[model samples]
Target: MIRSINVSSATLRHGIIHSPFRLVTKPSNGLRFCRVRPLSRPSRPSIILARLYSDEKSPKENIKPTELAKKVLQEAAKRENIYTIPNMLTFGRLLASPVIGYLVVTHQTSWALAVFGLSCVTDLLDGYIARKYNMQTVVGSVIDPMADKTLMMTLATCLAVSGDIPLYIATLILGRDFLLFLSALYYRYISLPPPKTFTRYWDFSLPSAEVRPTTISKYNTFLQMIYLGSSLVFPVLSQSITIETAQSIGMALKGLEYVVATTTILSGLSYVFSKDAVKILSKPNGKP
Candidate 1:
């Protein structure tokens, strides 16, 4: 027969059977459990924090702080009226000039063609957009033409070094640019204050030269770009196509080159002997 007894504290006081607790306790299978205190509720601040953070978006992984900084800077630049779209395009071309030259020297004809093509497109686009929108800055007047000159000089030098084009042609092309650069410096030196060390090193400023491209010079530049582009592209195409086809294209480019050379020489001479050029170079004393 099974027996069950309800023992009070008085019965447990004798220590005949050990009780685990001095207060209320229970026993089962020779183990004792005392009454447990309940856990306290979370603090108000903790609850508020949990609720506040619960719906927040998880932080994006693999995002660089520098990248975020660059984006913020770009937005700030837009607001500050410095990096307008047309100026950005001109700056891009300036940056690309060296890469194009490198590609030409390394015999990466296809890539050179692609880069030169893009440069041409951006050149036209930047000028058109600037004029159409009336967003021409004083800085753009200096930088846009400088970018064009730099790209032309780079391409001419590379082609001359590679022996794909005659050395005299490159010399003629670059000599014109050098003369114009000197002319600009001469004008600015007379007109403006002496430059700081940094500005002097670059030889660039807002008021450098306001010389617009002569119509003949514009055609000359177009022809020069065409000649350079064709020189890079034809060699690559010849590798895939027949020699006869390549020869025909080569003859056409040669013909174009002659026209370009003639125009280039004429434009340079015209620029040097122009009334404005004479005035800038031979300024009268005490005229101010």
Candidate 2:
């Protein structure tokens, strides 16, 4: 009876342990089982990466127009053709003209005289530099002569107004200028052709055949400078030399004035008679 009881108990325990519900509910034989869906990683932000690359490359790709212009200007400045010593001297003389005029107008006679002397010195230096360095230019040729005439004319007018120089001297100088202007106009218009060849005596050995300063013209320039310098001294020395000395100096300047006037007239006539001058004058307005 006891053995039967024991066997029954054992069978009951085995049935409980091997039940299918228990097996399905719990893991068996130390193995884990899980049903899981595959994970989907977050999508990479490609748009943000593209924008970062574009931002990094933009400055290298974009160049401003002004920067390009500055580069071109720098290249132009590096060229060898433009800067010359003679031209620099001529520019200095030109700049001096206005300063001299201002000094004279302001009644700073000594300063004006000093400035005028500087202008004259620059004139000589320009010519010397041009010859020494072989740095002549067409622009210099025109500008140099024009600057000289302009300075002389300004000084003469100012001195006349200040009563430092006789009115006759100013008149003579202006008259000469006027006559040359008229001749130039006539040569351009009515003459149809101007004379080209200059007399040996009238030629100053300038490279240009059309315009050359004569020996007389050079002397005239020297005398004009002397006259102007003497006027500056006359005012200070008047007490010592008395009226006679002033009058004597005035007479001498007047004589020089006549010589210049005569030479100018004769030279103009000679230019008018030159064959090449005629040829140049004869060209029609557009026939160059």
lDDT of each residue in 1-288, candidate 1, tens digit only:
223344322222222222222334677688776552323454443333333232232334333445544444433332224377999999999999999999999988878888999999999999899999988865676678779889999999999999888888889889998888787666655644333244543443324335666778888888888888777777677889888888888889889888878998998887766764323311223122
Name the candidate that leads on lDDT.
1
Q: Per-prediction TM-score, please?
A: 0.64, 0.53
> Highest TM-score among the candidates is held by which one?
1
lDDT per residue, candidate 2, 14-133, as tens digits? 122111111122345776543323223322222222233333335346434455444445333322332577767777777787787677777887788788888888889988988888
Q: Among all windows of ten consecutive residues in candidate 1, which has the lowest summed lDDT?
A: 12-21
Model 1: what TM-score? 0.64
